[model samples]
Target: MFDVEFVVDIINKSGSSVEVKLDDQAKKFSQIGLDSLDMFNVFIELQDATGKEFSDDIVENLVSISTIVEFLNS
Candidate 1:
């Protein structure tokens, strides 16, 4: 199961240039200063760590940390 802290850790470990400090679980990746490339890298890192694939189609819907956590947990 995934949590906000785990998601935040993954984003930080993703090698994204932006620093990760998530106060709101509902905060979108864009609002956190992640560009498309950063998002891609973050997803890849998440897949690698969690052994879960993030399909392209559904990636658009996973805009926030809370959403990602819910998806992973589900």
Candidate 2:
């Protein structure tokens, strides 16, 4: 299950120690020190984990941890 905690763990383990909670819906990725390249890697990892391919539009709108989880759920 690719939930917020899972995502946060992945992000933190990936070298950025970003702390995220369930209510961080309005927070942007950059505010947590997540750069473009870092996000790109996370996107790839998420795809592999979920076995789902996200389109360019979905990737573009993934501005926050909430958005990422929403997209995964969608």
Candidate 3:
């Protein structure tokens, strides 16, 4: 259980909404039609939305939506 809903909204706003699932977390962002910049944008939006700061390490682990939720909830 994590901030999946918030992350989904971010993903949607980032550009595309591809119906992310826990299983998608193990795959790369491109696998779901997003690029690295889009992911970075999502993180930036997240930072703005939650007032939380994220490190570069978060990007490394953000290969999938599950990982994004994990990092957001963290």
- Best candidate, lDDT-wise? 1
Per-residue CA lDDT of model 3 for 24-71, tens digit only, reads: 656778887787667777878878887778788657767777777776
Candidate with the larger lDDT of 2 and 3: 2
lDDT at 13, model 1: 89
User: Could you tell which candidate, 1 or 2, scores higher by lDDT?
Assistant: 1
Top model by TM-score, which number? 1
TM-score of every model versus the real structure: 0.92, 0.76, 0.71
Query: How high is the CA lDDT of each candidate model?
Result: 0.88, 0.74, 0.71
What is the full ranking by TM-score, best candidate first? Answer: 1, 2, 3
Report the C-alpha lDDT of model 2 over 1-74, residue by residue, as the tens digit.
Answer: 46888766656556554555556656898876678888877777777777889788878998988887788787
lDDT of 1: 0.88
TM-score of 3: 0.71
TM-score of 1: 0.92
Task: Report each candidate's C-alpha RMSD, comma-separated, in the order given.
Answer: 1.0, 2.4, 2.7
Worst 10 residues of 2 by lDDT: 13-22
lDDT of 1 by residue, 1-74 (tens): 67899999999888897878768578887888889999999999999999998998879899988999999999
